[model samples]
Target: MRLSVAVCVPLALANWLLFSLSTMWADLEPRDLQFQSPLAWLALWANLLGIALLLAVLWRFGLEILEALAAAIKQLFAREVDWPAWFAELYAGLRPLPLFTLPAAALWGAWLVLFYFFDHPGGYATDVAFQIAAHALGACVYLPIFYRWRVLTKASSHDPQISG
Candidate 1:
């Protein structure tokens, strides 16, 4: 699980960088130039490969990764933790979709509004900063719901009769 996260995060960041570069190039380059550029093609393929790998890791080992993260976070604030009881209480009556979607929508809406009001033609650093900020915002919106869903899935998997 730790290995999966260590690999997945770097791949995710690389994908983001490639995606940002490709989009920025598209905006800045002529159509002919874009079509003829090897760097553009390389970036595209790299981004796709990174995405595929990241998704594969997440699909296979995501539950364990989230569980590990949850455990670590729990350890931070408490000396003694009851794993079963904590998870039971945490996931009790949980509805992940609304929890994820509502906050995500609100956050994205606010981000868009901020971009509209504050966007300017800046250099690479500024664009990268904006991209990082956007990804961080998305992470904030998705991580908790993802953790919840993963824990629920893990719990359900342990009991054959139960379904999530």
Candidate 2:
């Protein structure tokens, strides 16, 4: 069960990326396009690199993810555990790292600017909106599981007094 939660992160990310990319690609045509500036290209690459690095890190630390998921699940269902504090700890622990933060900010800033300036066609606007929502949802689903794993491992190894 823990392993499944850990595995779901990458799987969900991959699915979201694939769906978003394919939809955006299909929306574009061979013509009727304007060339982007070098700065735009840099921003695009930076966002991509940042996301790839985030995913790589998560995948590499699969065991920790599993541990977190298990711990979270235990705390969530156990009436004796303070579920609110568990959530607070989870949020504090999973606060965005620089690797994820800068790139994510760049991506978000770019999207906001694009939405403000450009007039999207057909259901393009809706598609983009859904993509953004999907990204948020993915984070919502992954963070708690990851945080639980981190806290559980930390408590077991270094803080034996801590309990669920």
Q: Which digits, one per residue and each the tens of the lDDT, describe model 2 over residues 1-164?
A: 23333444454455445434443444567584333566755655566677767666666774477457756576665434444545565555445333344444445444444543353333586657747865875576567656675665456455544444
Per-residue lDDT of 100-156 in model 1, one digit per residue for the tens? Answer: 444444544444444433553455665576667657755754566556645655665
Which segments of candidate 2 are over 4 A away from where they belong? 1-76, 80-92, 95-98, 121-126, 129-161
State TM-scores per candidate: 0.44, 0.31
Model 1 scores worst on lDDT over the 10 consecutive residues at 93-102
**Highest TM-score scorer:** 1
Query: Candidate 1 — which residues are off by over 4 angstroms?
Result: 1-34, 97-99, 102-164
Clash number for candidate 1? 0
Estimate candidate 1's alpha-carbon lDDT, on a 0 to 1 scale.
0.54
lDDT of each: 0.54, 0.53
